[model samples]
Target: MHSIATPKLTASMLALALLLAGCATSPDFGETLETRSEQASAIAGDYKKGEKLIEAGRKDVREGRKLARKGENRVNRGEDRIREGEAMMAAARAAYCRDTGYATPECR
Candidate 1:
């Protein structure tokens, strides 16, 4: 009777130890799921910020191109005015030389 009792008591103790060990090592499912959800939210926020920056950059480029075209048109108009002024000066010099019967240094 003593030998039979010892074997049964030993088996019961072994089973209890295994149950405690399993509880100690088990993962907390709720905390793991929450952590993953927060990480995904952060990634989505970063993507939105990047998209906004890209759109702003595109808008800046468009405005810069418009300003450059305006500047080029202004320069062309100034050049045309300069050419007209030179032709008027030449005509005035030629008329002065023809009427005075003397060539000035500038007219020559």
Candidate 2:
């Protein structure tokens, strides 16, 4: 009777071990390594300058949009719209430089 119980316990332990193994996830597939490396290389990449300008320009756009939304008069609304346009121009300039390595005079 003791021997029969020993075999049953051994079989249950093996089954539990297999089940625990199944719970383990594949390594690195669980994580998102958002490397911009490939995208950076694909672009003409003056890298730091282009990225910085884009960030600044995008911030300007967001601020201008917020201002436009708050504006009650035509004058205030016009000013905000002008700001948004300028921001878009700057962002375009940055993208052009990133793609072509130079900005057009108008973009500048």
Candidate 3:
């Protein structure tokens, strides 16, 4: 009889200990998950904003490249014009030297 009573008391004590342990570690299912969800959404929004900024920066870079290429083309054209003008001047100097029969220093 005493042995049966001892086993029952032990079983009850074990059950009570497990119950308290479970209660101590129970999760808060509402506010904790809600707060975490909000945080996740905010992070996603920030990520999207960052992507937009990066796209804008890339567009600006492309525009800058186009402008630089245009400027380079203008410089090349200016150089070509200068070379053409120099050639014309040389031809005119040669003609003047031959027509006047006076060899000028520019003809050499």
- TM-score to native of every candidate shown: 0.56, 0.29, 0.51
- Model 3 misplaced regions, further than 4 Å: 1-42
**Overall local distance difference test of candidate 1:** 0.68
lDDT of 2: 0.59
Best by lDDT: 3
* Candidate 1 residue runs with Cα over 4 Å from true position: 1-38
Clash count, one per candidate: 0, 0, 0
Provide the overall lDDT of each model, using Cα atoms, as 2-decimal numbers. 0.68, 0.59, 0.69
Instruction: Encode model 2's per-residue lDDT on 5-106: one tens digit a residue.
Output: 456433334444433443344244443222222333333234445667989999999999988777747788788999999999989878987777565565
Tens-place lDDT digits, model 3, residues 25-108: 547535354454455455556666776898999999999999999999999999999999999998998789898786667655
- Superposition error at 75 for model 1 (Å): 1.5
- Could you give candidate 1's per-residue lDDT for residues 5-94 as a string of tens digits? 456433335445444544455466354534544544555556557768989999999999999999999999999999999999888988
Worst 10 residues of 3 by lDDT: 8-17
Better of 2 and 3 by TM-score: 3
What is candidate 2's CA lDDT for residue 9?
A: 31
- The true-versus-predicted C-alpha distance at residue 96 of model 3, in Å, is 2.2
Q: How far is candidate 3 from the true structure (C-alpha RMSD, Å)?
A: 20.4
lDDT of 1 at 93: 81
Query: Top model by TM-score, which number?
Result: 1
Residue pairs in candidate 2 whose N, alpha carbon or C atoms collide under 3 angstroms: none
Residue 82 of model 2, lDDT score: 100
